[model samples]
Target: MVSTVEVPEADAQFWRDWGDPLLVSIVDATLRANHDIRIALSRYEQSRALTHQAGLDRYPTLDVSGDVSDRRVSASQAFGLSRAHRDGELHTANLSVIWELDFFGRVRRSVESQRADTEAHAADLAGVQVAVVAEVTDAYFRLLGLQRRLQVARDNESNQADTLRLITALFQEGRGTSFDTERVRTQLAFTRSRIPPLEAEAAVTANRIAVLTGREPAAVVTMLDRSAALPVYPAQINAGVPSELLRRRPDIAAAERRLAAATARIGVATADLFPRFTLGGLVGTQALGFNTLFQRDSETRVVSLGVGGSFLDVGRVRSRIAAANSAAAESLAAYEQTVLIAMEETEDALVRLSHAQAEKAILEQAAEASRSAALTARQQFEGGMVGVLEVLDVERSRLDVENLLAQSATQQATALVAVYKTLAGGWPQLIPEPQGDAMAQR
Candidate 1:
């Protein structure tokens, strides 16, 4: 249940100012260029056409015709008596109307079935839209995470360099042991090694975003040179009950639409077991010359009606009904499964965000303690109270804690993205409007 208490709108300005421009652009591009969405739209169009065709089944068809011809026959082959070398011209004009009388409701049922299918396709399109939004959001957050991690690596590398320099200077002056100097140098090298891999990872993520945005990878890489930081959340978050989420989820709606379509198909199959009726009429004039084709004396009219039913197709109709029922059942199952998955995702993201926040708090304390211990060790070593190894060990612990803090921050950002994905609230609004001139320039 939604809370009756008023909830203020979230202030996502940081995410908006930094990531929104790129994320919106990418989401719009993906919506316009994604192959699957395009395919689904085409399928919807096809269903609309089929629905129109089905509706037409209840109407009469009119055809107009006109023809002119010349004929010659030998006297011996002519009926009765005819002179040799005889030629005649014939001209005819006609109008015909044909209609199927749907007394047994077969046409009505077919039309209903096609209408249901059309609705199903429309829902499928909506589902595709939701999926695309989720994917783009996830990618954008992941790219941000990678960028932040790279920054952390760089900062850690710089810190290690500073520590190594201090240790080397002390060792040269005989104030620190050789082992302490070597250990600092080793840690510095390891920190530096991390930079290259993190940079590569960030590059790969940028490329993936580029592909989603339907742009060249190099172009995205050129555009994304800014530092990455985790996004801040609003003071309040609203998570309605399970029912609210189920109703909001696009996949569940799509599956339900499919079930409706399948149920309609059963009606269509059942209608097929009944008889069909058709009415046809022809009004025409025939004459030996075009001048008399429309004359009252030459006019002829005919009206015909037909009804047909298949007595041998009972088994086939029953099989179709059974298949449609099965399909409806399958769709219901799928809808339930989608609901379960969406709930699972929301709960998991919530847990992760809370845990990461707690972890960040602990890690902050650990880092502060390590920093103090390192400072104390340095003072002790200068006063001849402790060895250089003690100072080096504390410094290493501090660096590790700092790295863990950075990781936790990234995890929190990822959790926020996951929450957005689960909610499926972002759509055309979250994505940017198209700028024709900007796109043309690109």
Candidate 2:
């Protein structure tokens, strides 16, 4: 039995030190350039402004007014009075204030709702930042994997070319059959044909990375040409529990905040069923001439208080409250669903990483055996120990094994990336300024 040894856990600080350089740079660049993050931040700022406006509803609004006018009066002869006309200017100003008492908590509820919305937007921004980091890191690793595969293909092509040359020399010397030479040449051509498509795929991956980093595709490719090393997974990760996921994930937090906002909206709607109260006062002066507008005796003042309520809108108010309740229920459901999805993702990533690691070992052994078989068959052909067909068959088997190994390596890398993504939580750690400077040099 082949003794199976578990791979040692990678040092967390080693992964952090190396992985941090590229990923942190990409994340920092993304945070500055990612359109989604910028948009969310802007929305959060707008929500903050709305919250401030909502709070203002609980305070009195004051207005001052002044006016100048000319008046003409005509007297009729009904009482035998003479008609007279006069022109005058009147100046008036008022400082009027209206304050909603909020006795029923209407303004308070509205303010609460706006504040919740602001919080939700802030959480949304954090979620976007996390997603951007994961995306950029995944793309970078994929590109590196492709580069490795491309190298493998080139190596295989060179080996096949050399084998074809040997077979041709044997045929010319009457030591090998024409069929053997033709078969080797055909395999070499097929191996070379795969290079173009792999190159094209690498280019596309580079373009995706550039767009994520908020740069032109061409510029990204230039940087990628110089960039090296794939992101390494940390040695240890704590997924916490399913319940902890709800608190850690930013999307879940945002959804809960939305629910709170919806609940507050219900209060706002219910408050409308009660009367609204306002207290207003005005101080103004009216004068026949602008020069005397500030005269103490010419000044006029009025203090007023008013209460207004819509008595005929009971049905409408009830409907609005019902709508708000339904909205609150919807938000709660959304929050629950987000939590469930996060748990699912964490579990799936864990399973995939475990399985991929196991599979890699099996594939590695298969590749080694296939290579040995191909070398033995080649020697047999040279020594007349086997037919040319046997040599062709063994070579093809070796190629297939090699390709499979490459694919398995990619799968393992992808699974590792998934594990990291699940454990990253909702916010990418902020890269310190000095670290960012070092990454730039790299």
Candidate 3:
């Protein structure tokens, strides 16, 4: 039996793989509102307009013009009269045509160069997306980590305070030494010092996220209230092969587009070495009065074809071609360098994540063991099996281990974000708005 319901098609998410709903919403908002993204988008729009403008040279342009004049001249003032210096009111109008015949492919190459530039701008926009997304993710996780660290420090301070009270009462009763009391006070003071720095960093990170989302720094102060919740994603993606980097990296694509544009510009420059063919003509009527302007006999027509080129300035044209060649060569090198940097970043992030995960695992076990040992040490000290110094040492070790574990976990999360940034391949193709009919080429 056929099902009675239809399933909806899924649309592309602002990002992929990371499945946190809040993250998805924030990223979507940033992509829409971020100033850097808007700037890149505007540059892409300009390139599109320039591409259409460049294509305009491949067609003839027609212009309509007219003039009306009253003239008077004396026969005696004429040097040699062809009808004793005729004078009259004159009226004229015409439609003019001008076209550069692109026999040397100059116009075609120019259009190609501009089209490639447009593609480069599109890729640049995507690159900006990758960077901004990575930044927001890093900042979000950093804030969470700082909050956790602050909580850990405050808890340690509270624990120290309890220990200090116990030592103070014992000392007052002549059961504890002065050294113990002073040691506990100093430990509490040290624990209290960590909170301020952590609080500062968390506030700063929160402000950064707010700005990233195009809001005031105070707008998102309380937006992320959760503590140290790092959503897990695959540590290693199953990318098919290294060749996929060519398609999956926006920087690489942008560099390749730049190379292509430079190569096409070489053709544009080389074409200038040859004579440029031109066609021009006018069609209209010229009459002494407006009443006869449309008369058949008064009709005027013209047609012309000419070629113009620089013979003495050939050195300048050659120099331009040489410059274009150098530009293409530079672009090629830059493309290669971009690919190398992309690979380096990917490998670095992957290795760091792997080691961070391993380190975090070890620290997790240490943290548990340290907490258990500290608790046992406190019980033993109460029974006089150990001194206050021993208990203090164990508690300090536990605090340090907890802090390390928090940092390692945060590093691992940010490393994943970096990996995603390196391989985002480019955002979904954001096609520019359709150009007007006026820009259409025939």
Candidate 4:
């Protein structure tokens, strides 16, 4: 039960209410294979790796280095040969470690920023899934509407063609004017013109749906070849409160996460004002000959404490802090704006949904009346009680109303998709296992 005090939770699988198994499958497949989803997922993975990299600063780093050299002294330079061997091999090896001592918490702040960024990317991935599902569903409904309208246009054109033929016969029989024939011819041609564009759009929409589902356009067309009517809702769905709509939308979540990352960055920049410290050590062995390598007398050890600060470069540090603050401010504004936009979209969708049924009913009644009038006018024309002009007028009216009705139906379906997208509370995670062979090919 939705209420004023508490916003009802939107169904995560709200689109399923259309009761279309095909739609469910298409949405699921799109979530699984859509290119945008894959890209977002990859980005999320990159952020996670970056976060891990940032965290690595908290631990010691180890490095191993070694070098060997051979020396030969010329006669002219033999003054060194008396003190050192003419031919010699020298070997050195060392293992070194360095660890940042984050007394000012710079490393911690950096890691915090990266972690928040990772979360933002995760939300971005979810947002992409929401958008892809909505887009596919919208295209599917539009395709069905276009197909219906195409059929209506063709059917109307045939009827008008028959009318033109009748008018031509009447004119030949001295019972109709040339204007009557021309008028009927014009209407027939106009109706025929609507066909090509509708067919083109329908084809494009089908291809869009196929692309969303990660399939070839031809395959999608084949799968959708079977005729389908628009799904009808028996009753209106409730539009929950604005607060809940904002809370659940993935875009809002993403924006909020980014804001958090920006805030963390401010801390990171502020930490730059303090001194940096590190703990470093070296443990190794150096020998004049291979035989002395690793001997107790050849062992070496080193320990160091390093401190670095930028008291003279305070301007640069201050500038960086200012930039981070600005970024956080921008993020906060963006988050707020996103909330407003989400609310606006949800309101628009709800408004359309509210008026959808009434508008549909009105057009349906008008279509019925125009259809009846056209039939009556045709009968009167055949019975010699009416002229071709009246019959043509009625046919035009009938076609206009029906075409409008088809468009209205499509709007209703698309509006519902908008509502679900705008109010996207949550959705099931549907990432499938990566197909290794397919991925390798890509």
Candidate 5:
């Protein structure tokens, strides 16, 4: 019954609801044009080409060649050659065909392995896409969080400046001591000092976003200069049952596909234990003169059936088969490990996200309380009911709480991104799988 519950609006399309257009655009660009994604795509293409080659293993091969030659043979060497080779101006043309009959399924198994490898690479590309999206989203959230912190620092600086002015005025009128004025000045300077480091952090994050989107740092800096607020966290998230992870997680899928490839390779190697049968044919004509090369009497035709095996090296073949089996075992273990890791990652993200939300709620209340206390202290200081030191202390507490609140927001965003990545969310489902199509045709 709980599983059937309707998902919240923000949970269904998390990015669309929580992410601004710029964030979405940056993530899209990163997935589409990032160098890492491009490299994965290139690797997928390489695997696809290998799959095509493997599929050709069962097909016959044919070739045609024509040659014209002039040669003079010595009298002593003529005894070891045919009359045609002993003369000059020999002309020959031939067509040859060679076909390996896959009676033992060697070629078929090879094709299967290659196809599985290709699918694994395709999954790898999807994983890269997922990672790039997560990274860009996480980085953008960090940038927003930093900006919020910077704003808080600047606000505090302004508040402290006002406090310092009041202290200066009180001192000028002999109502405040030089020590109080100097202490307020020190607090104001400290507040002002926070701005530069915050600005630097924000700038670095912006540059990271720019590189993620395959753009120049200056361009990203210009684009991100526009003011934006951190997104509100969604109250309800529907993370479907863990079983869905097998299908949704690209890394797991990749590992599983690799295991399939490795298993298929065992068959490929085992096939080597049996005899290999090959059928070859040659049709040709030869004559001393080019015009007579195609003449009826000059025609020649030959056909042959070849059978070969590693009968003399049975130990070598068995060793190869054993190695393939061991590799398949390793791949199986890896697949299992990947599945466990995927589940662990998703669970970890969920736990962390929950904790971050709980922490943020408490911090939000603390910030509100601190804000009220700061306001009250400032009022009391102006009314001569409290010291400036009390006001500064409250203000400092408020600043720290606000900064923690911003960091909490960033942590939540990071955890959410991790969840999405582990789930392989936003994978390009519509992307063409060329190897699948080829396998279907086969």
Candidate 6:
């Protein structure tokens, strides 16, 4: 089914180019400051260090040893040991080298496994980057939506208040009944009630964005205090094909890299079942006199080639191999699952975006019609052609539809973010650095 899907350049950067500058800046800041992303980057560094350490095993190892000591001996003890009684200084130095031959390819396989592990960690970091950006973008859009809803509610409240005043004036003048005045007041109160909760919800969403950006919640609330309009999105989204998900989605890439690492580890484990070979040598000189420490006559040399294997614990080695194979199998399954999830999320986002656009269009028309109806009803009521309740009902319906319109716009924006996230849209190429360092660079 995926094979039949239209594919584009899935790895392209859509969000950075298309998103609002403020939102893009927020996402960039979050990527650099968000603790989760920092943690993943740290893990990537650790993996790189491990890989380098593993590669070091491929080269010969060398070390230097030296010792200097002074001792005073008693006359009887000195005579018994060396036929001399005196205070003496002794010095010794040694340089040793050990190189393990990769006859069974253990070192190579281990290095390969570590390299794959490092790549897996890099992919993990990318996945975290994608997640943080998406989270911040979603929060931003939601906050804007709530703010717009609050504005609509307030506008409705004001309109209803004006109606209540007119109705109260009419009742006082003996032109309207007390029941109509009370009903208008009640309607105004209900409309006013929606404001506080919407404001609170908007504030919470702002706090979420602030936290995502690694700032204090109150500080974020202050920063985002200025009312802003909802962002505009491009009419058409270019979502690449389904198969592009394998390369574009970080979770899929991470899962695949982990699978590769697991496969490499199986080879590493298998290498343990074979004989290990090493060659070690030491060349050093020791002398009783410090001046003669480097003299040829004091030179000592040793060299050896060694081979060892686990003869008794064969079952343990096989068990490890079996475990590695099992892990590889699990990673493979995880990779498949990741691919499916990426595809599902992308498809869902596409569907949501399409529906939100359609709904927004319909709601826009409904809101306009309601506004016209409310105006007509108000005019009719003033002329004694309609009751106050009829005007109130139409105004309330207009408010409801306008609120839905605002929410639908938010949904469309959020769905766009989801699509970009599912496509792994914004992150740059791999240049792993510490969080502090990355931020400093920015």
The prediction achieving the highest TM-score against the true structure is 5
How would you encode candidate 6's per-residue C-alpha lDDT over 1-442 as one tens digit per residue?
Answer: 0011122222325446544677667777787688888788788888887888888899999999999998778867667665344778888899999998998778888888788777777777877877777788889878878877887898899899999989999999999998899889989999998999988888888888988988888766876776567755655666656765577776787788789889988987888888888899999988988899998799988999988867357999999999999999999999888888887888898788788877877887787788889989999999999998898888889888988888887888788788778778633332221222110121
lDDT of 3 by residue, 79-106 (tens): 5776535678889999999999999999
Task: Write down the RMSD of all candidates, one decimal each.
Answer: 8.0, 9.2, 10.7, 8.9, 9.7, 8.3
lDDT over C-alpha atoms for residue 96 of model 4: 99
Tell me how far candidate 1 lies from the true structure as C-alpha RMSD in angstroms: 8.0
Kindly report which residue stretches of model 4 are placed more than 4 angstroms away from their true locations once superposed. Answer: 1-12, 71-86, 164-182, 425-442
Q: Ranking by TM-score, best first?
A: 5, 6, 3, 2, 4, 1
Candidate 3 stretches with Cα past 4 Å from truth are 1-19, 74-88, 225-228, 425-442
Clashing residue pairs for model 6? 7-241, 8-241
Consecutive 10-residue window with the lowest summed lDDT within model 4: 1-10
| Estimated TM-score for each candidate | 0.81, 0.85, 0.88, 0.85, 0.90, 0.89
> At residue 267, what lDDT does model 4 achieve?
85
Clashes of each: 0, 3, 1, 0, 0, 2
Candidate 6, residue 141: Cα displacement in angstroms equals 0.4
Better by lDDT, candidate 3 or 1? 3
Q: Candidate 1: where is the Cα deviation over 4 Å? A: 1-19, 66-77, 80-89, 298-300, 367-387, 426-442
* True-vs-predicted CA distance for residue 375, candidate 6, Å: 1.1
Q: lDDT of each prediction vs. the true structure? A: 0.69, 0.72, 0.79, 0.79, 0.79, 0.78
**What is the C-alpha local distance difference test score of candidate 6?**
0.78
Considering summed lDDT, which 10 consecutive residues are worst modelled in model 6? Answer: 1-10
- The better candidate by lDDT, 2 or 6, is 6
Misplaced by over 4 Å in model 2 are 1-17, 73-85, 226-229, 371-392, 424-442
Give lDDT for model 2. 0.72
